[model samples]
Target chain A: MTGDEACAEGALAAGCKFFGGYPITPATEIAEHIAKRLPQVGGVFIQMEDEIAAMASVLGASWAGVKSMTATSGPGFSLMLENIGLGICTETPCVVVNVQRAGPSTGLPTLGAQSDMMQARWGSHGHYEIIALSPSSPQEIFYQTITAFNLSEMYRLPVLIMTDEIIGHMSERVVIPEASEIQLFNRIKPEEKSMPYWPYIPGADGVSPMAVAGEGYRFHITGLTHDEKGYPVMSAEAHVHMVERITEKIKRNISHIIDTEGYYLEDAEIVVVSYGVSSRTSLSAVYEARSMGIKAGLLRLKTVWPFPEAILRTLASRVKGFVTVEINLGQIHLEVQRCVGGNVPTFFVGHAGGTIIPPEHVLSVLKDAF
Target chain B: MSIQSDQSDQQTHPLDDLLRKDRIPHIWCPGCGIGTAFSACLYAIKSSKLDLDHVSMVSGIGCSGRGAGYINLDSFHTTHGRAIPFATGLKLANPDLTVVVFSGDGDLFAIGGNHFIHAARRNMDLTVICVNNLNYGMTGGQVAATTPHLAKTTTTPAGNPETPFNLPLLAYASGATYVARWTILHTRDLTESIGEAIQKKGFSFIEVLAPCPVNYGRRNKLKPLDVLRIYQEKSIIKHFASPSELHLDLEKGITLGKFVDQDKPTWLDMYYKTTRKKS
Candidate 1:
C-alpha cells in the first residue's frame, strides 16, 4: 500500500470515526481512501470548503465524542494554524497529517521535502508544545498515524504526522495488525456525572478528562484563556495557568512521548542524526562510513517534537562529532546543535530542499566531522 | 402570554436549568438587545421538544458568540468565523444531535461568510441564529458586512460605503431550507420563529436585528428606545415575500417574517442515500 492509503487505514484502525479534509496534493489520497472506507465502518467523512474549515470540522467532530482527523500539505497546513491553536486551548484530541511538499509558497506541490518540521513545532501563534512524528516509509507512516491518534487522545491535543511527498507517495508492503493487536488509548472521561464538572482540572497525568457534546455533561469549551470551569478569564495570571497546564502535560510525559532508534552507537566516534526520509539516507551513509573503516553511527529520530534532548545530549558527550542531515535548510539540525550545546562539534548537511540529500553528501559530512 | 409570564418573579426562571448561572452577569452592554434574542433561543430550545442532552450550541468570537458560553448544554465557543463549519462537523458526526450556531453578523457574514454560504448550500441540518446589530459591537462599533450603507462606524468614520447584505436574500440565494428575520422588539414572533426553525429540517437561518445601543446606536444617534421604536413602527410582517424586497430601511419599512420555508434533503440525508444500498 502507498503511505497515504496506509495512513487512512491507520486512522481507521485507531477508531477515527470522522475525517474532515480538502484536496491537497500528496495528501489527497489519504482523504480519498478514508472517504471510501469511513462510511463502510459507520464513520463520517466530510470534504469541507477549505483547509481551515477542514481543521475546524475535525475539532468539532472530536468534541462530539468521535476520534477525528484531517490531512493537508504545507499550504493547507498554514491555513490550519489558527484552529490548531483552538484545539490546543480547548484540549481537543485529533490528528493532523501534513504530507509535506516543498514550499515557501507552493514551491513543489508534487515533490518531496521535509521543510515543514519547524512549522509543525511553532506554526501556531502562541506559546504551546506540540507532538509531531516523522515516518520514513509507507509502513512507518501506518504505525505512526495510529501512534499519533493514541498520543492525541492520551495528551488531549492535536498530534501531527509529518511525512514528506516521497514517503506519502511511496508504495510498500505494510503489515495490517489485527484489531486485537493494536493498543488504543481513549481519552479519559469524567466519572462523576452528578457533580459539577470542571473541564480543565488536570489529573495526575496533567490531562483533564474529556466530555463530549450531547453527553449531558453540559460543559463549556472555548478558545479563550479560560479557567478550570471553562469560563473565559481575561487576565495575564489566568493565561499563565492555562498555558502551563497544556504545556506541562507534554513536558511531564516526555519519557513516554519520545522515541529514537540508534544504529551502531556503541563506541562510535562520529554520530549522524536525522529523521523521516533523511534518516534513511543518513543510515546508508553510516553504513558506507563503516565499510570505509570509519567509526560512524546513525541516530534515527522517530518522534521529532520534545526533541529527544536528553538522548542527544548523552550521545554528544560520548561521540567525537555529530552530522545532522535533513531535506530542509537546517530545521532539526538546530535542535541537535542546541542539545549538543558545544560539548562536541556539530556539522549540517542539507539544502533549501526540493530533492533528497544524497547518501554520498551525508558521507562527506560524516567524513569531515570525523 | 409566555413572554409576559416570564417577567413575573417566578421562584426559579424557566431557563435556569438551561443556563450556566455562575457565568451570569454577562458582558452585554446595558442597552444591548442580545439578551432578548438569546432568551428567545433558550425558550425555543425548551419548546422545540428536541432532547436537550442531545443538543449542542457553537459560536464564533463576538458579543453574540458569548451565547454558547452561557448555555448549559454542550457548548463550544470556537475561533472567529468558523462556527458554521464546527457545527457542521458536530451535526454530521452525531446526526442525532440538534446543533445550533449562535453568533454575530460580523462572525457569521464577514469572517465566516464562506462557511455560511457553503453550509446553507449543502442544506446542513443546523439552526443558525445571527444577532445582527449593524456593526462590530464588541470592538467599539467598527464597520461590519451587515452595517447599513451610509451608517457611521469607527472604521467608516464618514459613513459606510458598502451596501449591507439583505440577509434573508442571501440565505435564500444560498438555498437555506428556512430563512426568517426578526428584531428583538418583536420578541413573541422571534421566539416563535426560532422554535419553528428548531423543529424544521435542513438549514435554518434567523437574522435577529438587535440594537447595539452603546457602539452602533450611540454613533447613529439612536438610543435604545429609539431603535425599539423603529422596530415597532417601521416593521412590516411579510411572510413568503420575495427576499429581494426585504432590505432594511428604518425610515420606510423593515420587512420581517419567514421569507423562505421549504423541505430539502439535508446533507446527512444525501450522504446516507448516496452511500448506503437500499434494502
Candidate 2:
C-alpha cells in the first residue's frame, strides 16, 4: 500500500467514521483514498471549503462522539491552528495528519519536509499540551494512526500524526492487521446519566471519560476559562483550575504516553536524534558511522510531544553529544537542547521547505561529533 | 378584546416561560432589535417541543454568538466563524441531537461564509439562525458582507463601496431547503418563521434582521425600532414578490420575508438510507 492508502486504512482500523478535508498535494491522496473507501464502509467523507473548515468539522464530529480526522499540508496546517487550540481547550478527541511539504507558506506542495514540528505543538494560541507522532514508513503511519486515535481518546486531546511528503507519498508493503490483533480504545463513558457531567473533570489518571451529545447528558462547553461544569467562569480560580486540569491531565501521565525507538544506544558515545522521515536517514547514518568505528547510535522519536525528555536526559549523561536532524530550521533541536540542559553539546543539521537531509550529511555530523 | 384573546392564547403555549426574565434588563441597548430576535428564538425553541437536553446551541464570536452562553440549553460557545462546520460535525456524529448555529452577519457571512454555504449545499440537518446586523457590531461597527452598498459604517466612513450580500437569496442558491428573513420588530412573524424553519427537515436558515444600536445606529441614523418598522413595511411574502425584484438596496432597504423552501433529503437521512440499502 502507498503511504496515503495506509493512512486511510489506519483511519478505518482506528474506527474513524468521518473525514472532512480539502485536497492538497501529497496530503490529497489521503483524502482521495478515504473518499473512495469511507462511503463503502458506512462512513462520511466531505470535501470541505478549505483547511480551516476541514479542521473545524473534524473537531465538531469528535464532540458528537465519532472518531474523526483531517489531512493537510503547510498552509492548511497553519489555517487549522486556531481550531486545533479549540480542540485542545474543549478536550475534543480527534486526529490531524500533516503530510509536511516545504514552505513558510505553500513553499513546496509536492515535495517533502518535516518543517512543521514546532508549529504542530505551539502554532495555536495560548499555552497547552499536545500529542504529536511521526512516522518513518508507510507501516509506521498505519500503526501511528491507531496510536494517535488511542492517545486522543485517552487524553481527550487532539493528536497529530506528522508525516513528511516522502512518507505520505511513498509506496511500501504494509500488512493490514486482523481486527482482533489491532487494539482499540474507546472514550470512557459516565457510570451515571442525567446528573451534572463535568466534561473537563480529570480522573485519577488525569483523563476524564467523554460523553457524547444527545446521550442524555446535559453539558455546557465554552472556549473561555471554564469551571468543572464547562460553563465560562471568569476568575483566577477558574482559569487556574481549567488550564491546570487540561494541561496536567497529559503532563502527569507522560510516562504512559511517551514513546521512542532506540538503536545501539546501550553503550554509544554519540547519539543522533531524529523523527519522521529523517529517522530513516539517521538509521543509515548511524550504521555508516559505526562501520567507520565511531560509537554512534540513533534515538528515533515516535511520540514528539511530552517529548522523551527523560530519555534524552539519560542519553545525554551517557553519550558524548547529541546531534538533532530534521527538515526544518531547528525547531525540535531547541527542545532537544532544552531537555539535555547543556549536559551534552547539541548540534543541528536542518533545512527548510521540502528538502530532506541526505544520509551522508547525517553521517558526517556523527563523524564530527565522535 | 381580540388582541387580549390572542395574547392569552399565545401564553398557553408550553415554551412561554423559558425566556430568561432577569437578564431582561437585557444587555442590548434600548431599541436594539436583538432583544426581539432573541425572543423569537426562545419562542421557536419552545414551540418545537424538542427536549432541551437533546438540543445544543453553538455560536461563533460576535454579539449574537454571545447568545449561546446566554441561552439556557446545552450550548457551545466556539471559535469565531467556525460555528456551522462545528455544528455540522456535532449533528453528523449524533443525528439524534438538534444542533443549531447562532451567529452574526460578520461571523456567519464573512468569516464563517464558507461553512454557511457548504452546510447549506450539503443540506446538513441543522437550524442556522443568522442575525444579520448589517455591521460587525461586537468588533465595532465595520461593514460586513451583508452590509448594504453605500451604507455608512465605522469602516465605511464615506460609504460602503462593496456590494452587500442578500443572505436568504444566497442561502437558497446554496441549496438550503428552508430560507426565511424577518426583522426583530416583527416578533410574532419572526417567531413563527423560526418555528417553521426548525420544523423543516433539511438545512434551514433564518436571517433575522437584528438591530445594532451602538455601532450601526450613528451611521444608519435610526433606532432599533426604526429598523424593525422598516422590516415590517418593506417585506412582502415570498409568494407575492418576483425573483428579479427581490434585490434589496442599502439606501432604501427592501423586502424581508420567507423566500425559498423545498423538501430535500438531509445529509443524515441520505447517509442512513444509503447505508441501509447497501446492507
Candidate 3:
C-alpha cells in the first residue's frame, strides 16, 4: 500500500470515526481510501468544500465525541492554519496529516519536499506547542499516524503526521497488527457524577477531561482567551493562565512526546540528522560512509516539532560535527544549528523542493562536516 | 393588576434556568437588539420541547455570536465564518443532536458566504439563524454584505456603493427547506417561527433584522427602538412570497414572512443510501 493509504488504514485502526478532507496532491489517496472504508466501519467521510471547512469540521466532530482527522498538502494546510490555532486554543483533540509537497505557492504539487517542517510548528498565528511526526516510509507512516492520534487524544491538541510526497506516494508493505495490540486512547471523559464541569482545568497530566456535546454538562468552549470554566474572559490574567497551562503541558512532558532513532554515535566523529524521506537516504548514506571508514552516524528524527533538543544537546558534546539533511533549504538545519549552539560546526545538505536530496549529496556533506 | 403579580423577582425571569446568569450584563450595548433575538431563540428552544441535553448551539465571531456562550446549552464558540460547517459536523456525527448556528450577517454571509450557500445547497440538517444588523457589529460598524446601498459605516464613511444581498431571497434560492424573516419587534412571532424551524427537517434559516445601536445606530442616528418601529410600520407580512419580490431596502417597504417551507431529503440521507448500496 502507498503511504497515504497506510495512513488511512492506521486512522481506522486508531478508531478515527470521522474523516474530513479535501483532495490535494500527495494526500488525496488518504481521503479516497477513507471515503470508501469509513462507511464500512460506521465512520463518516466528508469531502468538504475546502480545507478550511475540512479542518473546522474535524474539530466539530471531535467535540461531538468522534475521533476525527483531515489530510492535505501545502496549499490546503495553509488554508487550515487559522482553524489549527482555534483547535489549540479550544484544545480540540484531532489529527492533521500534511503529505508535504514542494511549495511557497504550488511549487510542486506532484513532487516531494520537507518545506512545511517549519510551517507545521509556526503556521498558526500564535505561540503554542505542536506535535509533528515524520515517517521514512509507508510502514512508518502507518504506525506514526496511529501514534499521532494517541498523542492528540492524550494532550487534547492537534497532532500532525508530517510526511513528504515521496513517502506519501511510494508503495510499500505495511504490517497491520491485531486491533487489540494497538493501544488506543479515548479523551478523558468527565466523571458523570462531576457536575458543573470546569472543562479547562488540567488534570495531573495537565490535560483536562473533555465534555462532548449532548452529554448534559452544558459545557462551553471557545477560541478566545478563556478562564478555567471555558468561558471567554478577555483579560491579561486569563490570557496568561490559559497560554501558560497549554504550553507548559507539552514542555514539561517532552520526554514522552519527542521521538528520535539513533543509528550510531558511541564512537562516531560525525552525525547526519534528517527526517521524512530524507532520513531514508541519510540512513543509506551513513551505512555507505561507514563502509568507507568515515565513522559517520545517523540521527533519524521521528518527532520534528519538539526537535529532540535535549538529545541533540547531549550528542553535540560527543560528535565533532553534524550534517542536517532535508528537502527544504536549511529549515531543520537552522534548528540543528540552534541545538548544537556553536559548540560544533553544522553543515546543511538541502534541496529547493520538487525532488529528494540524494544519498551521495548527503554523504559528501557529511565528509565536509568532518 | 397587583404589583406583586406584575413585578416578578429576578429569579423568576423566564429562561433563567437556561441562562448563564454569571455571564449577565452581556457585551451587547444598551439598545442593541441581539439580546432580544437571543431571548427569542431560548424561548423558541423551550417551545420546541426538545430535550435540552440533545441540543447544541454553535456560533462564529460576532456580536450575535456571543449568544452561544451565554446559553446554558452544549455550545461551541468557533472561529469567524466557520459556524455552519462546524454545526454540520456536529449534526452529522450525532444525528440525535439539534444543531443550530447563531451568528451575524457579516459572519454568515460575507466571510462564511460559501459555506452558507453550500450547506443550504446540500440541504444539511441544521438551523441557521443570522442576525442581520446591516453592519459588522462586533468589529464596529464596517459595511457588511447586508448593508443598505447608501448606508454610512465606519469603513464606508462616503456611503456604501455596493448592492447588498437580499437575505430572504438568497436563503430561498439556496435550497433551504424552511426560510423566514422577522425583527425584534416581532418577538412572539419570531419565537414561534424559530420553533417551527427547529421542528422542520433539512436546512432551516431565519434572518432577524436586528439593531447595532452603538456602532450602526450612532452613525445612522437611529436607536434600536426606532429600527423596531420602522420594522413595524413599513414591513409587510407576505407569507410564501416570491423570492424575486422579497428584496429589502432601507428606503423601501420590507417584505417579511415564511417565504419557503417544503420537504427535501438531506445530505446525510442521500449519503447513507449511496454508501450503503455501494458497500
Name the best candidate (by TM-score). 3
Which prediction has more favorable lDDT, 1 or 3? Answer: 1
Identify the runs in model 3 with alpha carbons over 4 angstroms from their true place. B1-10
Each candidate: RMSD:
2.4, 3.7, 1.4
Arranged by DockQ, best first: 3, 1, 2
Question: Model 3 reaches what TM-score against the true structure?
Answer: 0.98
Per-residue C-alpha lDDT of model 3 across residues B1-279, encoded as one tens digit per residue: 645563545545788888888898789989899999999999999878899999999999999888899999999999899998888878878889999899999999999998999899999999999999999988879999988887899999999999999887888788999999998888888999999999888999999998888999889898878888889888888999897788575666888889899999999998998999943
TM-score of chain A of each: 0.99, 0.98, 0.99
CAPRI level of candidate 3: high
The positional error of residue A163 in candidate 1, measured at the CA in angstroms, is 0.5
TM-score of each: 0.97, 0.93, 0.98
Candidate structures ordered by TM-score, highest first: 3, 1, 2
- What's the DockQ of model 2? 0.59
Each model's iRMS: 0.7, 1.8, 0.7
Assess candidate 2 and give its TM-score to the true structure.
Answer: 0.93
Error of 2 at B56 (Å): 2.6
Name the regions of candidate 1 deviating beyond 4 angstroms. Answer: A192-194, B1-11
lDDT digits (tens) for residues A230-287 of candidate 3: 9988899989899999998899889999999998777778989988899999999999
